[model samples]
Structure formats: structure tokens, C-alpha cells
Target chain A: MMETIGIWVAAFLTLSMFSFLYKDNPFYKFAEHLFVGASMGYFIPYTFFNVFIPYAYNPLFLRHNYWLIIPFVIGLGYWFRFSNNLGWLSRYPIAFSMGIVGMGVPMSIHAQILVQMRTMMLPLTNINLILIFIGTVSILLYFFFSKAHEGLYGKFTSVGIWFMMVGFGASFGYTVMARLSLLIGRLQFLLGDWLGLIK
Target chain B: MNFSDYIQKIDRRYIFIILAIAVILPLLFPLGLPTFTTPPVLSLYKHIDEAAGTDDRAVFMDFAQSPSTLPELYPMDLAILRHCFLRDIKVLTISYYPQGAAIMQMAISEVKEDFPDVKQDVDYCNFGFRNFALRVPITLGMGDNIAEAVETNAAGRRLENLPIMEKLKNYDNIQVCMEISGAAPGIIYINYARARYGVDVAIGVTAVSAADNYPYLQTGQLVGLLGGLKGAAEYEELVETFANNDIPYSEKKAQNLSWRNQQYELSKVPYKFKQARIGMDAQAVAHVLIIIFIIIGNIGYFIEKRQDKNKYVK
Candidate 1:
């Protein structure tokens, strides 16, 4: 009986969301607010119990990890943003985070940039490899703002534009598929899971 | 306005209705449109098939997907879990997002319903959700001691007490770490886990982020990828095929059949399990509708242009 009631509530919300296709209405707004409120309601407790208690409280108190106290103090600095007198103190935590991220940037570059460049440097023995090399070079050339895109360079940049367009088109097509999949999920829930209209 | 203008300026509500019909009709009566596996997905399947069961090598699943992405990502999660259970592959599951813990739990429960004899904490364990800020340290720590890195399961039970962690100590026992997320954590895993510990990484990402991971796949950072609903559908096909060949229908598939497909033949998969494929049907129909509309709109546009040109000439 609880499951049935849950299904009805879900079906109502699903239709409420779908109602936007006609025009904006109170149902859609209610569903939107409910979703946000429900998410927050779920998030706060889960974070407190699962994240804060385990990662913070357990380590500081149970483990007697005195070193953690430093980071704990730094984390507390974030709360200072609420104090008009000490609002500037929040920058310490922000700066600390930025510094840590700065140290991590090189690692990201190593994986995302350096490694990618190395892969692109492979011997172009095959036609597919040759095309890839060409596409890569031309696309890079297209973004070289200092150089004038004219004559032969212009043709290369134009080819790069085509490559970009093709990439965008593929991405767009997949985006459509993704959106439709979400709709299909909702429809399945309403029709099959809720109404038993589908086998 | 002429027919062309009318077609050009057709009410969007009409299109919405058509799309609704396209989606609904397929659900009611599945067309069973065929799905093909891509190279990235096949690469992932092949890696798991070859490396999973040997030397205590387990698959570490990072459940980073949010609820909004469940429709697209959940099927892939379910399919992977089903595959792991069927192959007797030791699995360790974790979630980064808070909501992901619930989704992972649901997937585990649904998949567990099939393998009754399979023991939890021994065969599979869920590490649950962690703070995003701790992602790097936790991943790096897993390189040394998984039990130490992840102290407890989602339920606050000690990880060392879990039977699966007895043999599985760290990255050495982990064959491939599959990170499924709407927002791809491929880079994070690649930078920390793979670069630091040599752990093989795979990604199951939403289609929007799928293209971004291609460079990683090409560079050998990611072993395999399942992108979006299509990827999920493809993976499902792989699982179904693998099950049909290896496990007899009566022994494995029959018992695990979803409630919706109880009346169907042993060969026929349940609708609940076949979500990705069923979704693909709606996808195909919707694509066709979009294409038809695009053509009609373009035709109207060209006609309008030609008529305007004639008026200027006159």
C-alpha cells in the first residue's frame, strides 16, 4: 500500500513536470519547489551523518589525529563569511583551496594535455591516423589568433571549422538522445510502473 | 499564411504531443529496435571479461551519478552489476555524491535479488558516499590500503570486517575502476588513481560529457567507456549475450527474470532489466520525428526564401 501511494505521488509529479509543455502552471512550480526542498532535506542529514561525522569527528576525536586540527581550523574560516567584521578571513580558506588546486594543475595538465599530445604524436602510417593528424593540426591552427587565416592558411582554418561543426553536430545529436532517454524513463515510470499500461 | 508558413510556424505543443505519442507507443508496444555496441563499450566489456576473475582482481565502481541522470546512467550501473555478479567478480562500490548512495543501494538490492546465494561483504560491498573534497586523498589512499582509505561502508561498518576486503587490499587487487557519472570523473581517476597507482580506469558518462573523454580513451588513460543511454543499451546487449552463452537459461537467467517478464519465455528478458533497450526504441522514433520535422521546416524555409526573391524580382 505504501508502494502504491509512492507510485501515485511519483506519477503526479511526472505529469506536473510534463504540464510545462502546454504552459507554465502552479503544478510545475510546486513540483520544482518540492524537488529542491526534498533534495536539501535528504542532502543535509546524509552529509552530517556520513561525511561530517566520519571524516571530521571520527578522525579528530577517535583517532587523535592532531594534524587534522589545522585543516579543521581552516575549514571553520569559511563560516566567517557570515560575520561582517571577519568577512575578510574567508579569503584565507579560499586562498588555501586555490593554492592546493594550483599545485594540482600540473597533474591535470600531465594527464589531459601532455599525455594527449604524446598520443597525437604517434606515427601516421594509416589513412585514419593521417586524417586524425590533419584534423588535429588544422583545428589548432584555427585557434592560433596571432596568425592571419588567409590563402592556404584560410583553407586549413575552413577545414578546421568543418571538423568543429561535425563534432558539434555529433554532440548535439547525442544531447537529443540523452534528453529523450530521460523522457522515456519518466514515461516508463508513469505507464509501466504506475499505471501498468505497458507490458 | 500559406501552407509553408503554417508548417513553419506550427505550434510547439503539437510537436510535444507528437513526441509524447512517439515515446508512449513504443513503451506500450516495443518495436525491439536493434542496438549495436561501440568500440569503447566493447573495450570495457573485453577488459572485464579477460581480467576480472583472476588473482583477486576486482572491479571498483564509483557511483558519482545524481538522481537527474538516473534514467540514463542507472541502466548501465545495473547492467555492470549484473555482469559482475554473473562472472563472480569481486566488486567494491563507492559513491561520491550523497544521492548516489541511495541509487547505488537500490541497484545493489535489485541485482542482489537474483543471486540469492551470493554473500554481501564477501562477494560485494558498498563504501558509500564521501565528500567531493576528499576525492583525491581517498583515491590516492586506496593505492596503499583500501580498508584504511575507506574506513567504513555506507552503513558505518568497518571495511576491514568485510569479507571482500580480506584478499582485496588495494589497487593491486583492483582490475579496473569504473567511474559512472553525469559529470565525468575520468580526469580525476586518471590523474590520481591511474597516474599514481597504475589502476586501469573506465568511465560510464552521460553523452554530453562522452566526447570530452575520447582523448583519454585514445591516450590509453581509460580502458573503456559507456556513453549515455546508448552506451547503457549496448552494455545491456553485451550482458544478455554473455548470459545466454555462458549461463544456462534455467539456472541463471530464469531465476533472475524481472517481475514484468515472468510470463515470457526463458529467452525473453524482463522489461525492467531491458530498460536501456526499451529506451532506445523511443530514442529511435524520436530521432526520426526530429529529422522529419527538420526536413519539413527546411522545406518551408526554402520556399519562403524563393517566394521572397520572386517578390523582389517583380
Candidate 2:
């Protein structure tokens, strides 16, 4: 059946990708390159259907609205890469998008990031929290002064380094967890969905 | 650097082999470990409840993610869509990513297994994928010529003729626009649709992008958010709880009047999410593996450093 063939193809593609984990072989390379090509080719029309024709051309040409052309013109500036004289025009939209995105960052920081970090930085009320606070503050101060960190100060800074190392260790652990989750997901598809071996 | 020094370096192949086993073993035989849903996930579920309400809430889901991220991303879309349909809310899906539309269609269809009577383009509509970015969303949400973008359903029938959208006044008919993406366009929706048009937005994004959305969620800009697989799992749990609580009866005489009877009168909800539950277990084990790797890598570094010191002292 067509469904069975689809499952097999999916399994093959997934295994082909995981094979890269063992060693950089031609199979991995072929699959990787194929994926890149397929994805890119897909994105063009995908963007065209989901973004352009609906948002731009529909409003501009179909509705005969003129102002909507602002983004349209800005988007067209990307083509300036081909024109030597007009290469500078590309920077206009780039600068505009930068300005807009830049404006968003400050708003986002005030609303989201700073508050979250502050929330994390709050004083721990428990004994464990107190030790963590003391260690974090002393280490942070040690770095702020930027001294060689010898004597009591050095000892204090060393505690900060230890806290930092632990935090970094947790982050690295989470990153691995995230990547491995994806790998497991692929394997699941190959075994359960594609091959029907585990289902 | 002697030839033996090169040999002393374990081949990357060894690392690959270990990673392969780490992934495969869990799938073949799961540990059934529990994953705790974090605060952000809880917040996201609450927001979805508030925005979608008890009425006919609509979601414009963008299921656009690479296979690399499908395991983490798809579950969130599935959970959210199932929650909406179970609550009898309408869902409208359009994909900005090409592969995304097909995937979204498939996810929606699976949800349909529960709601057999729900007709496509009546109770739901697949506008397919569009490419115009901000321009398209602004136009569509503004209630302009949306038909021009996806003129017809995926089957090539015109949308104007479709019963659901025929009377759709504007994007106001939509209660939420949820974008599950791995890239910039989802954020673009946040800025253009939610900010500009006051659309309630929820984003289900990867962990890396999830942090970035904190600002949006904090700003009250994004109504709800599901981050990676953990968030998806949490959402699924919330729906399961909602479904259980809504069930009509525990008493024998009342059993006939149970919510299950009403549910049977309406849609057929699948028992539960099979894939996401399994993924959560794999994730917990994978977290342990990563922690172990980090420790080993650090030990290797320290060992090499001590050897270098010995050489210098000699």
C-alpha cells in the first residue's frame, strides 16, 4: 500500500540522518544536502502563498490600496544585491527593520527579561538559599572589582566561580537534553510510525 | 604530538554510537519517567483558557517546524487543537511554512477522528500556506481579501463558497492565533497581528526561542505560550483534567446522563496523546545523559590539564 511505502521512506530518511552520529559518511551528507535543498525549495512558494499573495498582492493590487506598498517597496529592496548602483538601497530596509526590531528589544527587556532575571535574583529565605545568595553576591562582587582575587577576596571569588560552574553545568545539561529529545523523537518515528516495529 | 597521542583521542564515532543508543533504548523500552511542567507552561495553559473561553474560540495554527524539531513541536499543536475542538471551539489553520500546512492538515484531521461530524470549512477551514509575511497577515486579519491568499481549500474549492468563512466578518471572529514555529515569522505574527491588530496570540516555540518569548508573554502581548515538549505535555495534562472534570456522572443511575454520553452525541475524542507522553519520558532520560556527558567532559579537561602541569614540572 501507498501508506506502507510512505512509512518506509520516512524510516530510511530518519536513519540516514542518525547515521551522521556514528561517523561523517556519504549517506549522512547526501541526506543532509537533500534536506537543505528540499526545505529551501519549499520555503519559496510557502512564503509566497502564506505571506505575499495574501498579505501584499491581495491588499495592493486586488483592493487597489496604495499605502500597503510600503513593506512591498521595502521588501523589494532585497533585490538591490544584484544592482551595483542600488546596493545602498538594501541598507534602507535593513536599517528600517533594525530600528523596528531595536525598538522592540527595549520594550521586551523592560517587560520580560529584566523582571525574570530579578525574580531569579531574589533573596532565598531558606538556609540553602542564604548560602547560595551569599556565594553568588561575593562572587559577583569579586568579578565587579576585577582584582587578582587573593586572600579573603580570592576565596570569595572562588565561591562565585563555583556557583557559575554549577549554573553552566545545568545549562549544558539542559542543552543536551533538548538535542537528545529530538534524536529520540526521530527514532520513535522510524521504529513505531515508519517501520511499525514497535507500535 | 606523537601518533599515539592521536589514538588516545576517542573517535567522534564512539560519541555517535553512544548517542544513538541513548536515543534508541528509550523508544524501544521507555522508563515511564515523569516530567514536571514548569511555571511558564502553567501560565500558558491559563492564558489559553482565558482567551479561548467556553465559547467558539478560533485558532489560526501555524505548524511549521523541521523534522529536527517535529518531536518537540507537533505535540504542542496537537494538544492545543484537541483542547479547542473538545471545548467545541472552532479552529482555522494556515501555514506559512510549506511542509507546515500539510502537517497542520494532518494534525487537524487526527483531531477530527474525535469530532467526526465537524465539517472542514464549516466548523474549521484550512487556508493553506501563504507567503506575504506581515502584509498578508495584516490584510487577512484586517478582514480584507483573505480569499485572495488561499482562494480555495487544499482541495482547490473556493473558500468564499465554504460555509464557515462565508459569513466570517473579519479576523475578529478568530479568538487566538497560535504560531508553532522555529524561526522569525512567528514573531512577525506577534508584532504584526497581535500588536497591530490586537489579536490574542499564543506561541509554541523551541527552547532557544522560548526565552525570547518571555518578554512578549510578560508584556501581556502573547496571551499564551507553550515552550517545547514540556509545555506541550503540560497543555495535554490540562485538557485531560478539563475533560475528566466535565464528565457528567459517577453514580449508576446518573451514568446514562454522564458527559461521556453527551460526548458520544457530539465528537469522539481520542483516549489520550500516545506520542507526547512517550517523548516526555525520553526527554527526562536524555537530560540525565547530558548531565553525565558534561561531568565527563569536565573530568577529561582537568585530567589533561594535570598532565600538562606534570610535563612542565619535569
Residues B1-314, model 1: lDDT tens digits: 89788997788888888999998898888886667667898788877766545547889999998889999999999999988888778889998788887899999999999889777888888888787767887888999999999898888888888777888899998989999998855778898888878889999988878876777888899999998899998888777766534542232433343521433335478777788888888888888998998899999989999999999999
**Which regions of candidate 1 are displaced past 4 Å?**
A65-70, B51-55, B244-266
Best-matching candidate per lDDT: 1
lDDT of 2 by residue, B73-137 (tens): 87887788777666556667766567777678778887788778777777778877654333343
Candidate 2, superposed: residue stretches over 4 Å from native: A44-173, B1-8, B50-56, B135-174, B184-186, B189-199, B215-219, B244-272, B304-314
Tens-digit per-residue lDDT, A84-143, candidate 1: 999888888778656557636877878777888888889988997787778888999999
Q: What TM value does model 1 have?
A: 0.93
Per-prediction TM-score to the true structure, in the order listed: 0.93, 0.70
Model 2 chain B lDDT-worst window of ten = B248-257
Clashing pairs in 1: none
Residue B207 local lDDT, model 1:
81
Error of 1 at B306 (Å): 1.3
